[model samples]
Target: MAATESLPVTGGRRLYVQLGITLVVLVAAGGMLAAHRATLDSGTDRLAAADGEWLLLACLAAVATWVCAAVAQQGAVAERLPAGRLVAAQFAACAANHLLPAGAGATVVNLRFLTRCGLSVRRSATALAVKAAVGGVVRCVLGVALLLASPGTVRLPARVPPALLVLVPVAVAAVVLAVALSARLRRAVGRGFADVREVHRSRARACALWGGSVAFALLHAGVVVAVVHALGLGLPTGRVVMAYLVASGAAALLPTPGGLGSLDAVLALALTAAGAPGPEAVSAVLGYRLLTGWLPMAPGLLVLALLSRRSAL
Candidate 1:
């Protein structure tokens, strides 16, 4: 009942978010044309001259992210949602993420979708939280796995810094102490543990949650790899993936919508650090954003608006 009641509110918010993004795009487009015309033209020419086959792979990988998102969302709960709508919702959510900060857009669209599909409000929110928690863990694990599987892929210090080693345990202890002392946080942690345990009870659900999340992260990184190859950038793929994971994690600290400017800047720096030339690194970042960010907007907007048209039950 609470879920049903909250649908209209979230749905309305999502509409506003999309509309706001449309306006920003229009304004940003004009600004870019006027302010960065030369750069735009350069990027356009570069994109035009890029390898078609690699670009196509990037596009496909970008689309595959939506499917993975849907799978993870489904795995977050025991209920079976309609596959088609789930994908559409994820598409719309991803689109919204580009406009709103801290995942506000995704929260709106997905929560509404879950409620519209009959999940209770609390369960819907919990599912989102659970998926997020699992996604973070999976990203770290994947990065470590890649490092171990591929020898000398990324350079790490042969020994941990003495000061850093001491600080790490202190930080962990501080966090645990805070959580243990805060009743609100304690309840939140309890709820998260309970939901995670429930998800683990179903073998398929656990696999989908972890596997889908890992695939989603890899596919997103694959876009960067494809774009690099498309532009004949000679950086190693393993290094690019590791750089992307690090840059993306850093970008999350900033509240930029879909990580627009923040991600571009950080990722470009990461690529450069990974041995890509500065200009080429920026170009690769532009190509990555073009595929992952801009390309999905049109379809996502249409899907969001269509979802908004339905009445709250």
Candidate 2:
């Protein structure tokens, strides 16, 4: 009787600890954003005086892309999920991703949610792996294609080291290969490929899902480009796309919450390599972060809170 009585108390304490940790992380991220505020504000002011219509369009594109991404994940798990439940699972997953470390905790949370919704862990894991691979491959292909199509726009300076260009492809390929070879990875992904027969039956749907995912990624890149343009910088579309892809890929590897310092550094470096002035590029990147990262996080937090309340009730 005593043990049962203490269980809720212990669980409540654990929840408090988790909340404390979350607060600390948010505080740190807030500090980092505050440090960059002046630069972000200046860039915002610059962009405000430029093409407002494009910025609005970019915002809409981002929202559409986010929904498309959720749909792609749904398609990956279609065998195990109903459409409405899949949409809720994805939104809940997104909300957790905004709150957790490396976005991985969200995956665990998503898996649990899927189980509650009647999906097996193995099936959910396979679907997630496929979604990640498809999204990554599409992003890289688009990035490289953009760079190739307009070499002059994305060209590194003659004085810049050749190693940087070599690094991009090598790094991407290595990451993909490593994932393919892992034992644990094989178990998760092998099943998805084994479902190749089923996939073939729905080949057109699969293709459409993959295409939508790619389009969604492109829309995200467009948002970054619009943010830069709003800052009164005239960047070539191809170059902006290339820079966004590279920076986004690199940012995924960052340890900081939501890629804090790491994303800004990579974006600035990529932009500089692509012919933008260093200060201007850094400013633009900071401004983009404001709109894409911090602004969205607030609403995500609200979603998370509402979900938690509903769960508790």
Candidate 3:
């Protein structure tokens, strides 16, 4: 009895310790963000004279992004998720994603949530893989379509880097080698493919999965469009949408948590190429990030903590 009781106590201490370390890391990241306050403010200032109504619309679009994400998550699994809890988990995952590299935190939260909601570990994992694969394909296809339509929005450099050409094949080969070398990985891939087929076997599931994903990307782009209109940016709406889809698809290649710096840079450059002034482009990106990333972060974190306390994390 003593040993068992002591085990829980020790486990509690470890959880707290881990939480403290997470807080420390978050604070460090916050400090780094603060260091760029001047740059952020300069961009934000450019929106001072913008229309309030447009900004409100942008906020609405941002809200829709979260809802769409939740819908997509629910669609990923055949089992129905409790509506309220599923949405809350998605919100929390958004916040958690910012804290860890390559969306690891979000993955952990979702995996735990799915398991708690009565999914086996493998099934839960398969749902995530299916969702990711489908979403990636949708985003890439949409991005390519947009890019092809508005080629001028993305300008290529005069000369391709020789190193990049070599690096691409090397990276591809390395990934293949890793998969070939690992039996577990090969099994996982096979299982994921089977899961994908299972998910698409249902017409309703297929619709929800694809529909939610398209809405997620489009609504996010709509937020940017709203910002452009709010700030009276002369950039064409179609090109702005194109630029966002293309840049975001490319930025997804980076492993940064939520694609923080890489996404910002890519978005800014894309917006500029699309013919918005540098300051205005930066301002629009800042506003977009403010709505999607910063504003909801605190509440998302709180929800995450509450869920964790309930052992639903």
Candidate 4:
């Protein structure tokens, strides 16, 4: 009787947490609209002067991230999922991702959606772990390959800024410290090894998993590169992508919602270190965020709310 009684309490707490995150997401979207440029931290002013065509390209690439995410989600599990609902869930999950630090919102939304798709809770959790681990591996591989293929492409700035020097060591140390201290994280790693074996049992599923993760990372990198071009900055595409990969990877270590402030800070410094003008580097970061985060948020929110109402997620 006691064990059963505690179940409701645990579930109720989870429900409350989900509701709180959803509320925060909705409020953020509304706030962005209401405050416009001021709320967005001056990105809008810079974007207004950029080339319209390139901006549109960035927006389109942002939209494609949903498709890639859905594909990867399917690959994470052996069982097939409903295509439409899967896409919609990815959309909504990304919107929620912006509100919670370290992608907690996105993970919750995906986990709930997988459960709704007739998966056992443990199996659904395993699938999530598989996807996360695969995604990380794919990102690192791509970053390394790009660097090896284009040696000397990433030129240093005339002088390394203090911000770059400070941020780099701090981010690396933070990640190392977090890994060393967390027993739970160690447990998760053990589970993730099980995840890899399960996900690779089917060749097709492995392809989808790897392919989707690759496209997802590349598409996001493309958005950043396009933004640089749109701003009329002459930074090489290779350096722009490298900067994004490094900054985003570092920012991922910190628990900031969608890498909001952390990503912005690190990205600007990274771009500066890559020799972009300070103002243009800032504008490039802002432009990419607007395209990827702000622009698609409303539709994502709507999809999320509807999925919630229908118990689809």
Candidate 5:
């Protein structure tokens, strides 16, 4: 009886600790964002004069990104989930994703959400792996297609640093080393792959997974494009889309909370390299971040808290 009583208390303490750490990270990220706002505000006058219609469309695209993400998440699972709850969970997960590097926070939230919806922990994890893998492959496909269509837009700089060349292989090695070190983890991965095979056997599941992932990526690009249009930056739409894909792919190679500063800087540079004016590109990136990251942050955090209180996490 005593041991059983202590279990809940211990778990509660652990939860508190996790939340506290997340809150601290959030605070730090906020500070970093504030410090970086100098670049963002460089074109505040232009930003203020942005076309409202295009800005509104960008906001809609942001909303669509979340919806598409929810669909992608749902498609990854075999069991039917409560639609409203699933979407809300994804909304909250987006906020959680920003609190940790490398999408770890969002992974945790979705893992818990999937289990709550009905699945063993292994199954839930497998579903997430499938979703991530599919999303990644689709993104790469889109990026490559765009690159081939407009090679000049995404052309590598004249000199590639030796470090940038080795980064990817090194990251792959690290992941392989981590997985190889744990027998239990290997088994989990094997099981996850098996689940992926099982889920893909269903045509509806497969289509939903691919379609939602594609839509999610496209909507994100749409947000950037809308922001550019709003700011009257006259870069080609194809180049902007290509820039977004390349920058996003590069940002994913590094683990940062919501790809905050790194993403903003890379994206803005990519836009300018593709021929957008510096101030206009900066303004567009700022608007995109506002629509996708900052504005939704507070409500998403609130939803996260609500979900946690209800044990939906």
Candidate 6:
């Protein structure tokens, strides 16, 4: 009886710890949101009159992107487990990402999920790294193509010129050189290439991954546009896209939790440079955060809750 009572107490203590950690993260994220919110007009009357259809579409697009992301994750882990299981693992990982400090928490959660599903830690780590690399490469390529194709749409500040174009090719060359220089990466690339060859697979998977990534990128950009539309702000689509890509790319490179403060700052600056009034741009960015960062977090938190309950049972 004492042991039974102690078990409940122990579990309760653990639950409290988890709740405390989650609350801390929420508080930190809220603080960042509040700081940005201060710069926004965020008038209740304006927010109330915002368009609904676009907001709904934005939510749909975000969900679609999440699904595509899960599919891509599954593809990367296909060799380790059934596709359905891998998809579930991906969703769980995404949920963890929302709750944890850095996005890396999602990767750790994913590795655990994969291990539970019978994959070795080493294999799971390798697969996750590959998936992340593929996703990042695809997004970067699409971002560059979009920026180049619609140069007029994506205006940089006067300080930034077309000469910045050199950075893209330079980045590509650097990556190729790095791959050649690193024996580990070279061997991995060689093995990956050989795997495709032996499986009679060409670049089909790569193409599909890139296509899906681009779709997600566009969908993410649409979220910002929808937010602006919802706020009744007449922002240019191209400018919005440019800001979204730049802010997103910078956030991806940052070590902060989900890029917290840095993303909002860059976005606000980008929008301002593109001729959006400061208050309006900040308002639009806040709305974008609500849709992209917070709304999904509710579902993610619920998923985490269910997982915890199952573990307790």
Best by lDDT: 4
Candidate 3 residue pairs in clash (backbone atoms < 3 Å) = none
- Tell how far residue 176 is off in model 2, in angstroms: 11
Better of 4 and 5 by lDDT: 4
Which pairs in model 6 have colliding backbones?
none
- Against the hidden reference, what TM-scores do the models get? 0.86, 0.76, 0.88, 0.82, 0.85, 0.73
Candidate 5 worst ten-residue window by lDDT:
21-30
Q: Per-residue CA lDDT of candidate 4, range 2-60, in tens?
A: 99999999988877876886687788878756655664666667779899899889988
- In angstroms, the error of model 1 at 251 is 1.5
Tens-place lDDT digits, model 1, residues 1-313? 9999999999889778767856675565345335535655667777889999999999999999999999999999999998988998999888778777877878878999999999999899999999988888888888899899986777787998999989989999999999999999999889889999999999999999998999999999999999999989888899999988988887877897787678889899989988999888888988887788676776676677676665321
Query: How many clashes in each structure?
Result: 0, 1, 0, 0, 0, 0
List runs of model 4 lying over 4 Å from the truth. 1-24, 31-41, 155-191
On residues 94-196, what C-alpha lDDT tens digit does candidate 5 reach at each position?
A: 8777767888978998999999877989788888999999988988999888878878766667998999889979999999998999998899878877878
Candidate 3 per-residue C-alpha lDDT over 1-313 given as tens digits, one digit per residue, 9 for 90 to 100: 9998999899899789768855775685587568768877786666777889999999898888778888888888999998888888988888888777777878988999999999999999889888888888888888777768877655678899999999999999999999999999999989988877887898888888899999999998999999999999878887888878877787678898777888889999989988989878889998888888877777777788777777777
Question: All candidates' lDDT scores?
Answer: 0.85, 0.68, 0.84, 0.86, 0.85, 0.68
lDDT (Cα, tens digit) per residue for candidate 6, span 1-313 = 9998899899999889877866775575466545655444454455557788887887787677766666555555545345554455555555556445557867876776667667778766766776677667766776688778887776556775666788888999999999989999998788666543432353545554555666767888888888787876788887788788888788777776666667878988888887888877877777776676765665665554555455411
Residue-level lDDT of model 2, residues 1-313, one tens digit each, is 9999999999898678656755664675567557767777766655657577777876776666657766676666554445554455555455456445566745765666556656778776766667777888888888777667776766565695789779989999997898788988676556778654454468665875687678778887888888777766787777878888888789887766566677779989988887788878877786566566666665655554444444420
Best by TM-score: 3
| Residue 135, candidate 6: alpha-carbon lDDT | 64
Query: How many pairs in model 5 have backbone atoms within 3 A of each other, for residues 3 or more apart or on separate chains, i.e. clashes?
Result: 0
lDDT of model 2, residue 266: 93
Better of 2 and 6 by TM-score: 2
lDDT for model 3 comes to 0.84
Query: Native-vs-model 1 lDDT?
Result: 0.85
